[model samples]
Target: MTQTKKTAKILRCPSCGMLVQPKDEDFPFCSDRCRKIDLGKWAMGVYKISSPVLDPDVLEDLDGLRDGQSRDSDEQ
Candidate 1:
């Protein structure tokens, strides 16, 4: 018996929940625009992966040491 051709796999578009077939050049996205949109999403939250190593709050003490504090100041 012979079987009809079938797509290797089906993938959902990350941008817009559309079904896509493996043979598609943009396998995860139905169109190139959708793929670009997915990339943009990743670009936006890239900060989490590269947050500043030293927070400004940690350096606040340095400024205080340089400038004498006044009694009215909030320093403890």
Candidate 2:
């Protein structure tokens, strides 16, 4: 029988540093704790925000704000 090889295609769980097998759905995190930590990093904006064109309401609000702010800037 041919054995399946595990490779770096597998990631260790960050929290426990467990070998967290490649087949696990949450392969790299090993448990919920690591996932939550990763999520917290994102929540803290450790990464820059992308443009909000992804949200129609945000884009509309920004457009409205831009018009008002620019009108004031032009008047000055």
Candidate 3:
């Protein structure tokens, strides 16, 4: 006879760092309060998703695009 072992996955809440289960109502957050706290942080600009433009070509292209857009808007 052969036997197999089962392992359960573990997850932690992002806001409170509490252990959370996938089956929980909040899933990733420990509670509704914690979930709202995370949302508030995003709404208040406490969290930002940004990266510096490293390539000169990409920067020039972006500036050109912006200038074109502004000219188009002014023409309208």
Candidate 4:
């Protein structure tokens, strides 16, 4: 006979710091309320990307692409 153990990963709700499971309907959040709260923080600009883009060239390329796309659409 052999014995086996099961392990599951644990996560916390970003809004309330409540322990949550990946299998939960809300996954990272404990409930829809917490999920909406987290989204509201983002919508209100409370959360931000602290790190700059890794590639300066890629950023410039993206800006150029945006400008090109806008000009192409205007000409159409």
> Which candidate comes out best when scored by lDDT?
3
For model 4, state the Cα shift of residue 55 in Å. Answer: 1.6
- Which number leads on TM-score? 3
Error of 2 at 42 (Å): 0.5
lDDT-best of 2 and 4? 4
lDDT of each: 0.76, 0.79, 0.95, 0.90
- Which candidate do you rate higher for lDDT, 1 or 4? 4
The true-structure Cα RMSD of candidate 1 reads 10.3
**What is the Cα-based lDDT of residue 29 in candidate 4?**
91
lDDT head-to-head 1 vs 3, winner: 3
Candidate 2 Cα lDDT to native: 0.79
Worst 10 residues of 1 by lDDT: 46-55
Error of 4 at 38 (Å): 0.3
Q: Candidate 3's residue-wise lDDT over 1-76, tens digit each?
A: 8998888877899998999999899878999999999999999999999999989999999999999999999999
Candidate 4, which segments miss by more than 4 Å at Cα? 1-7, 59-76
